[model samples]
Target: MNFVHNITAIFIFAPFLAFIILLFLSRKKLKRGAIGFSADITTFLLFLSVPVSVEALWGVNISFAVSVTAILMAMILLVLEWKKTKEIEILKYVRKTWRLYFLLLAAGYVIIWLTGLALTVISF
Candidate 1:
Protein backbone atom coordinates (compact mmCIF):
# COMPACT_ATOMS: atom_id res chain seq x y z
CA MET A 1 0.00 0.00 0.00
CA ASN A 2 2.84 2.40 0.79
CA PHE A 3 4.57 1.47 -2.42
CA VAL A 4 1.35 2.07 -4.34
CA HIS A 5 0.96 5.48 -2.73
CA ASN A 6 4.54 6.37 -3.54
CA ILE A 7 4.05 5.38 -7.17
CA THR A 8 0.88 7.45 -7.42
CA ALA A 9 2.66 10.44 -5.93
CA ILE A 10 5.48 10.14 -8.42
CA PHE A 11 3.03 9.84 -11.29
CA ILE A 12 1.22 12.96 -10.14
CA PHE A 13 4.46 14.91 -9.80
CA ALA A 14 5.95 13.70 -13.08
CA PRO A 15 5.03 16.85 -14.97
CA PHE A 16 6.76 19.08 -12.45
CA LEU A 17 9.74 16.79 -12.54
CA ALA A 18 9.81 16.98 -16.31
CA PHE A 19 9.69 20.77 -16.13
CA ILE A 20 12.68 20.78 -13.79
CA ILE A 21 14.53 18.42 -16.10
CA LEU A 22 13.74 20.59 -19.10
CA LEU A 23 14.97 23.66 -17.24
CA PHE A 24 18.34 22.03 -16.71
CA LEU A 25 18.67 20.48 -20.18
CA SER A 26 16.96 22.81 -22.64
CA ARG A 27 17.48 26.37 -23.72
CA LYS A 28 15.80 29.02 -21.58
CA LYS A 29 13.35 29.90 -24.35
CA LEU A 30 12.29 26.28 -24.90
CA LYS A 31 11.82 25.65 -21.20
CA ARG A 32 9.73 28.79 -20.84
CA GLY A 33 7.61 27.85 -23.84
CA ALA A 34 6.89 24.37 -22.56
CA ILE A 35 6.10 25.54 -19.05
CA GLY A 36 3.99 28.45 -20.23
CA PHE A 37 1.96 26.23 -22.53
CA SER A 38 1.32 23.70 -19.80
CA ALA A 39 0.33 26.47 -17.40
CA ASP A 40 -2.16 27.87 -19.91
CA ILE A 41 -3.97 24.56 -20.35
CA THR A 42 -3.97 23.95 -16.61
CA THR A 43 -5.40 27.39 -15.82
CA PHE A 44 -8.04 27.21 -18.52
CA LEU A 45 -9.35 24.03 -17.02
CA LEU A 46 -9.30 25.49 -13.52
CA PHE A 47 -11.26 28.58 -14.56
CA LEU A 48 -13.82 26.46 -16.37
CA SER A 49 -14.29 24.27 -13.31
CA VAL A 50 -14.64 26.97 -10.65
CA PRO A 51 -17.31 26.09 -8.14
CA VAL A 52 -19.12 28.00 -5.39
CA SER A 53 -17.82 26.42 -2.27
CA VAL A 54 -14.95 26.64 0.16
CA GLU A 55 -14.89 22.88 0.44
CA ALA A 56 -13.35 22.69 -2.98
CA LEU A 57 -9.59 22.80 -3.44
CA TRP A 58 -8.09 26.16 -2.50
CA GLY A 59 -5.31 26.19 -5.09
CA VAL A 60 -7.66 26.12 -8.05
CA ASN A 61 -8.38 29.85 -7.84
CA ILE A 62 -4.72 30.78 -7.61
CA SER A 63 -3.83 28.43 -10.40
CA PHE A 64 -6.67 29.79 -12.50
CA ALA A 65 -5.37 33.33 -12.11
CA VAL A 66 -1.78 32.41 -12.85
CA SER A 67 -2.80 30.31 -15.83
CA VAL A 68 -4.91 33.07 -17.35
CA THR A 69 -2.06 35.54 -17.00
CA ALA A 70 0.41 33.06 -18.42
CA ILE A 71 -1.87 32.38 -21.39
CA LEU A 72 -2.17 36.08 -22.15
CA MET A 73 1.60 36.49 -21.98
CA ALA A 74 2.08 33.46 -24.18
CA MET A 75 -0.34 34.90 -26.74
CA ILE A 76 1.70 38.07 -26.88
CA LEU A 77 4.87 36.09 -27.41
CA LEU A 78 3.17 34.02 -30.10
CA VAL A 79 2.15 37.12 -32.00
CA LEU A 80 5.66 38.47 -31.79
CA GLU A 81 7.02 35.16 -33.00
CA TRP A 82 4.62 35.20 -35.92
CA LYS A 83 5.70 38.68 -36.93
CA LYS A 84 9.36 37.79 -36.70
CA THR A 85 9.10 34.46 -38.52
CA LYS A 86 8.14 36.27 -41.78
CA GLU A 87 7.16 33.02 -43.55
CA ILE A 88 3.47 32.50 -43.92
CA GLU A 89 3.49 28.72 -44.29
CA ILE A 90 5.95 28.20 -41.47
CA LEU A 91 3.98 30.54 -39.22
CA LYS A 92 0.83 28.60 -39.95
CA TYR A 93 2.53 25.35 -39.13
CA VAL A 94 3.91 26.73 -35.91
CA ARG A 95 0.53 28.10 -34.91
CA LYS A 96 -1.23 24.86 -35.60
CA THR A 97 1.26 22.71 -33.75
CA TRP A 98 1.78 24.96 -30.76
CA ARG A 99 -1.71 26.35 -30.19
CA LEU A 100 -4.10 23.69 -31.42
CA TYR A 101 -3.70 21.57 -28.33
CA PHE A 102 -4.40 24.48 -25.99
CA LEU A 103 -7.42 25.49 -28.01
CA LEU A 104 -8.85 21.99 -28.00
CA LEU A 105 -8.17 21.49 -24.32
CA ALA A 106 -9.82 24.78 -23.43
CA ALA A 107 -12.86 23.95 -25.59
CA GLY A 108 -13.23 20.53 -24.03
CA TYR A 109 -12.95 21.97 -20.53
CA VAL A 110 -15.56 24.61 -21.30
CA ILE A 111 -17.94 22.05 -22.73
CA ILE A 112 -17.61 19.74 -19.75
CA TRP A 113 -17.98 22.58 -17.28
CA LEU A 114 -21.04 23.95 -19.04
CA THR A 115 -22.64 20.54 -19.19
CA GLY A 116 -22.02 19.97 -15.51
CA LEU A 117 -23.38 23.39 -14.60
CA ALA A 118 -26.49 22.80 -16.68
CA LEU A 119 -27.06 19.43 -15.04
CA THR A 120 -26.69 20.90 -11.58
CA VAL A 121 -29.01 23.79 -12.32
CA ILE A 122 -31.62 21.49 -13.81
CA SER A 123 -31.44 19.14 -10.89
CA PHE A 124 -31.91 21.96 -8.45
Candidate 2:
Protein backbone atom coordinates (compact mmCIF):
# COMPACT_ATOMS: atom_id res chain seq x y z
CA MET A 1 0.00 0.00 0.00
CA ASN A 2 2.86 2.35 0.73
CA PHE A 3 4.33 1.59 -2.64
CA VAL A 4 1.00 2.28 -4.28
CA HIS A 5 0.70 5.54 -2.40
CA ASN A 6 4.17 6.54 -3.47
CA ILE A 7 3.42 5.76 -7.06
CA THR A 8 0.19 7.68 -6.89
CA ALA A 9 1.98 10.62 -5.36
CA ILE A 10 4.42 10.58 -8.22
CA PHE A 11 1.57 10.44 -10.69
CA ILE A 12 -0.16 13.34 -8.98
CA PHE A 13 2.94 15.51 -9.03
CA ALA A 14 4.10 14.55 -12.50
CA PRO A 15 2.10 17.29 -14.20
CA PHE A 16 3.42 20.03 -11.96
CA LEU A 17 6.93 18.77 -12.57
CA ALA A 18 6.27 18.78 -16.28
CA PHE A 19 4.84 22.29 -16.08
CA ILE A 20 8.03 23.54 -14.48
CA ILE A 21 10.11 21.81 -17.09
CA LEU A 22 8.08 23.21 -19.91
CA LEU A 23 7.79 26.68 -18.43
CA PHE A 24 11.48 27.07 -17.60
CA LEU A 25 13.69 24.36 -19.04
CA SER A 26 12.36 23.12 -22.31
CA ARG A 27 13.35 24.90 -25.56
CA LYS A 28 12.32 22.56 -28.28
CA LYS A 29 8.75 22.82 -29.55
CA LEU A 30 8.09 19.12 -29.47
CA LYS A 31 9.47 18.74 -25.97
CA ARG A 32 7.36 21.63 -24.66
CA GLY A 33 4.18 20.27 -26.21
CA ALA A 34 4.87 16.78 -24.93
CA ILE A 35 5.43 18.02 -21.42
CA GLY A 36 2.29 20.15 -21.52
CA PHE A 37 0.18 17.27 -22.77
CA SER A 38 1.62 14.91 -20.18
CA ALA A 39 0.78 17.41 -17.47
CA ASP A 40 -2.77 17.74 -18.75
CA ILE A 41 -3.43 14.02 -18.91
CA THR A 42 -1.85 13.35 -15.51
CA THR A 43 -3.97 16.11 -13.95
CA PHE A 44 -7.11 14.77 -15.57
CA LEU A 45 -6.38 11.34 -14.15
CA LEU A 46 -5.81 12.80 -10.69
CA PHE A 47 -9.15 14.64 -10.76
CA LEU A 48 -10.88 11.38 -11.70
CA SER A 49 -9.30 9.55 -8.77
CA VAL A 50 -10.31 11.96 -5.96
CA PRO A 51 -11.99 10.29 -2.98
CA VAL A 52 -15.13 11.50 -1.22
CA SER A 53 -13.57 12.61 2.05
CA VAL A 54 -12.20 16.09 2.71
CA GLU A 55 -8.67 15.86 4.02
CA ALA A 56 -5.23 17.21 3.45
CA LEU A 57 -2.72 14.95 1.73
CA TRP A 58 0.98 15.63 2.07
CA GLY A 59 0.16 18.93 3.76
CA VAL A 60 -1.85 20.18 0.80
CA ASN A 61 -5.60 20.51 1.00
CA ILE A 62 -7.75 19.98 -2.09
CA SER A 63 -10.18 22.83 -2.45
CA PHE A 64 -12.00 23.93 -5.57
CA ALA A 65 -11.85 27.54 -4.47
CA VAL A 66 -8.14 27.37 -3.97
CA SER A 67 -7.67 25.77 -7.36
CA VAL A 68 -9.72 28.45 -9.08
CA THR A 69 -7.92 31.23 -7.30
CA ALA A 70 -4.51 29.83 -8.14
CA ILE A 71 -5.43 29.42 -11.76
CA LEU A 72 -6.72 32.97 -12.05
CA MET A 73 -3.67 34.42 -10.36
CA ALA A 74 -1.31 32.47 -12.54
CA MET A 75 -3.12 33.47 -15.69
CA ILE A 76 -3.02 37.11 -14.68
CA LEU A 77 0.71 36.97 -14.16
CA LEU A 78 1.30 35.10 -17.37
CA VAL A 79 -0.76 37.59 -19.31
CA LEU A 80 1.07 40.47 -17.76
CA GLU A 81 4.36 38.94 -18.64
CA TRP A 82 3.26 38.19 -22.16
CA LYS A 83 2.08 41.75 -22.65
CA LYS A 84 5.37 43.08 -21.42
CA THR A 85 7.50 40.84 -23.63
CA LYS A 86 5.41 40.48 -26.75
CA GLU A 87 4.00 43.09 -29.09
CA ILE A 88 0.40 44.21 -28.73
CA GLU A 89 -0.63 42.18 -31.77
CA ILE A 90 0.86 39.04 -30.28
CA LEU A 91 -0.80 39.82 -26.97
CA LYS A 92 -4.15 39.36 -28.66
CA TYR A 93 -3.35 35.75 -29.39
CA VAL A 94 -2.18 35.27 -25.85
CA ARG A 95 -5.41 36.74 -24.61
CA LYS A 96 -7.45 34.37 -26.74
CA THR A 97 -5.48 31.32 -25.67
CA TRP A 98 -5.17 32.41 -22.07
CA ARG A 99 -8.35 30.70 -20.93
CA LEU A 100 -7.20 27.33 -22.15
CA TYR A 101 -3.86 27.74 -20.46
CA PHE A 102 -5.51 28.66 -17.16
CA LEU A 103 -7.95 25.80 -17.45
CA LEU A 104 -5.08 23.37 -17.80
CA LEU A 105 -3.34 24.86 -14.81
CA ALA A 106 -6.53 24.61 -12.75
CA ALA A 107 -6.99 21.02 -13.82
CA GLY A 108 -3.44 20.24 -12.80
CA TYR A 109 -3.93 21.81 -9.36
CA VAL A 110 -7.13 19.88 -8.77
CA ILE A 111 -5.38 16.67 -9.66
CA ILE A 112 -2.53 17.45 -7.32
CA TRP A 113 -4.98 18.07 -4.52
CA LEU A 114 -6.95 14.90 -5.16
CA THR A 115 -3.83 12.80 -5.53
CA GLY A 116 -2.61 14.14 -2.22
CA LEU A 117 -5.85 13.11 -0.58
CA ALA A 118 -5.74 9.69 -2.16
CA LEU A 119 -2.20 9.15 -0.92
CA THR A 120 -3.22 10.16 2.58
CA VAL A 121 -6.03 7.66 2.54
CA ILE A 122 -3.69 4.96 1.28
CA SER A 123 -1.15 5.70 3.97
CA PHE A 124 -3.74 5.12 6.67
Candidate 3:
Protein backbone atom coordinates (compact mmCIF):
# COMPACT_ATOMS: atom_id res chain seq x y z
CA MET A 1 0.00 0.00 0.00
CA ASN A 2 2.74 2.41 0.87
CA PHE A 3 4.49 1.67 -2.41
CA VAL A 4 1.33 2.43 -4.31
CA HIS A 5 0.95 5.67 -2.42
CA ASN A 6 4.55 6.59 -3.15
CA ILE A 7 4.15 5.99 -6.84
CA THR A 8 1.03 8.11 -7.03
CA ALA A 9 2.73 10.85 -5.08
CA ILE A 10 5.60 10.87 -7.52
CA PHE A 11 3.25 11.05 -10.46
CA ILE A 12 1.40 14.00 -8.92
CA PHE A 13 4.49 15.90 -7.88
CA ALA A 14 6.75 15.43 -10.88
CA PRO A 15 5.57 18.52 -12.69
CA PHE A 16 5.67 20.55 -9.52
CA LEU A 17 9.27 19.56 -9.03
CA ALA A 18 10.08 20.75 -12.52
CA PHE A 19 8.21 23.96 -11.78
CA ILE A 20 10.30 24.58 -8.71
CA ILE A 21 13.42 24.07 -10.75
CA LEU A 22 12.16 26.58 -13.25
CA LEU A 23 11.55 29.08 -10.49
CA PHE A 24 15.06 28.62 -9.19
CA LEU A 25 16.48 29.10 -12.67
CA SER A 26 14.43 32.26 -13.09
CA ARG A 27 15.96 33.72 -9.95
CA LYS A 28 19.41 33.10 -11.44
CA LYS A 29 18.36 35.14 -14.49
CA LEU A 30 19.24 32.60 -17.13
CA LYS A 31 18.58 33.24 -20.81
CA ARG A 32 14.93 34.07 -21.46
CA GLY A 33 14.70 31.75 -24.44
CA ALA A 34 15.75 28.72 -22.43
CA ILE A 35 13.52 29.53 -19.51
CA GLY A 36 10.56 30.38 -21.72
CA PHE A 37 10.84 27.10 -23.62
CA SER A 38 11.20 25.09 -20.44
CA ALA A 39 8.27 26.87 -18.91
CA ASP A 40 6.15 26.00 -21.90
CA ILE A 41 7.14 22.37 -21.57
CA THR A 42 6.54 22.25 -17.85
CA THR A 43 3.16 23.80 -18.40
CA PHE A 44 2.34 21.20 -21.00
CA LEU A 45 3.31 18.43 -18.63
CA LEU A 46 1.32 19.94 -15.81
CA PHE A 47 -1.71 20.12 -18.06
CA LEU A 48 -1.12 16.57 -19.23
CA SER A 49 -1.15 15.35 -15.66
CA VAL A 50 -4.66 16.61 -15.04
CA PRO A 51 -6.67 14.22 -17.15
CA VAL A 52 -4.50 11.37 -16.02
CA SER A 53 -4.98 12.40 -12.45
CA VAL A 54 -8.70 12.48 -12.96
CA GLU A 55 -8.68 9.02 -14.44
CA ALA A 56 -6.63 7.73 -11.59
CA LEU A 57 -9.05 9.07 -9.01
CA TRP A 58 -12.30 8.40 -10.89
CA GLY A 59 -12.04 5.48 -13.33
CA VAL A 60 -13.07 7.52 -16.34
CA ASN A 61 -10.99 7.66 -19.46
CA ILE A 62 -10.41 11.19 -20.63
CA SER A 63 -8.56 12.77 -23.49
CA PHE A 64 -5.49 14.95 -23.10
CA ALA A 65 -7.40 18.04 -24.05
CA VAL A 66 -5.41 20.29 -21.80
CA SER A 67 -2.13 19.58 -23.55
CA VAL A 68 -3.66 20.19 -26.96
CA THR A 69 -5.23 23.44 -25.80
CA ALA A 70 -1.98 24.64 -24.32
CA ILE A 71 -0.20 23.90 -27.61
CA LEU A 72 -2.82 25.80 -29.55
CA MET A 73 -2.62 28.75 -27.21
CA ALA A 74 1.15 28.77 -27.49
CA MET A 75 0.89 28.84 -31.26
CA ILE A 76 -1.51 31.76 -31.09
CA LEU A 77 0.73 33.66 -28.74
CA LEU A 78 3.76 33.04 -30.95
CA VAL A 79 1.95 34.41 -33.94
CA LEU A 80 0.81 37.43 -31.95
CA GLU A 81 4.32 38.05 -30.68
CA TRP A 82 5.75 37.85 -34.16
CA LYS A 83 3.19 40.34 -35.37
CA LYS A 84 3.94 42.69 -32.52
CA THR A 85 7.70 42.44 -32.85
CA LYS A 86 7.48 42.84 -36.63
CA GLU A 87 11.01 41.55 -36.98
CA ILE A 88 12.31 39.15 -39.60
CA GLU A 89 14.75 37.80 -37.00
CA ILE A 90 11.88 36.03 -35.27
CA LEU A 91 13.29 32.62 -36.12
CA LYS A 92 16.62 33.48 -34.55
CA TYR A 93 15.34 32.78 -31.06
CA VAL A 94 14.24 29.31 -32.05
CA ARG A 95 17.48 28.64 -33.89
CA LYS A 96 19.53 29.53 -30.84
CA THR A 97 18.03 26.68 -28.86
CA TRP A 98 16.80 24.30 -31.51
CA ARG A 99 18.37 21.25 -29.94
CA LEU A 100 17.05 22.07 -26.53
CA TYR A 101 13.62 22.68 -28.00
CA PHE A 102 13.68 19.34 -29.78
CA LEU A 103 14.70 17.53 -26.64
CA LEU A 104 12.02 19.22 -24.60
CA LEU A 105 9.41 18.44 -27.23
CA ALA A 106 10.34 14.78 -27.14
CA ALA A 107 10.40 14.71 -23.36
CA GLY A 108 7.02 16.40 -23.14
CA TYR A 109 5.36 13.82 -25.34
CA VAL A 110 7.07 11.01 -23.48
CA ILE A 111 5.86 12.33 -20.16
CA ILE A 112 2.31 12.59 -21.46
CA TRP A 113 2.28 9.03 -22.75
CA LEU A 114 3.95 7.58 -19.68
CA THR A 115 1.65 9.39 -17.32
CA GLY A 116 -1.39 8.28 -19.22
CA LEU A 117 -0.26 4.69 -19.10
CA ALA A 118 0.55 4.88 -15.42
CA LEU A 119 -2.84 6.36 -14.67
CA THR A 120 -4.61 3.65 -16.58
CA VAL A 121 -2.66 0.98 -14.78
CA ILE A 122 -3.19 2.47 -11.37
CA SER A 123 -6.88 3.04 -11.93
CA PHE A 124 -7.38 -0.68 -12.16
**Which candidate has the highest lDDT of all?**
3
Q: What tens-digit string does per-residue lDDT give for candidate 3 at 6-76?
A: 86567454765665666677756666555565565565555556566556656765555545654565566
Residue 122 in model 3: lDDT: 92
Candidate 1, superposed: residue stretches over 4 Å from native = 1-35, 39-95
With a 3 Å backbone cut-off (N, CA, C), the pairs that clash in candidate 1 are none
Question: Could you tell me every candidate's TM-score relative to the true structure?
Answer: 0.30, 0.32, 0.40
How accurate locally, in lDDT, is each candidate? 0.50, 0.54, 0.59
**Model 2, 23: alpha-carbon shift in Å?**
18
lDDT of 1 by residue, 1-124 (tens): 9999785455332333433454455546665576555544443333433321211323233445545765776677677767987654665655553465455445544554567667689989
Off by over 4 Å in 3: 1-14, 17-45, 88-124
**Better lDDT candidate (1, 3):** 3
lDDT by residue for model 2 over 5-107, one digit each (tens)?
A: 8866765545455455544554465664665544554445344333222333444356575457547875776687677867445555554445454465556
In terms of TM-score, how similar is model 3 to the real structure? 0.40
Q: Candidate 2, TM-score vs. the true structure?
A: 0.32
How much is 94 displaced in model 1, in angstroms? Answer: 5.7
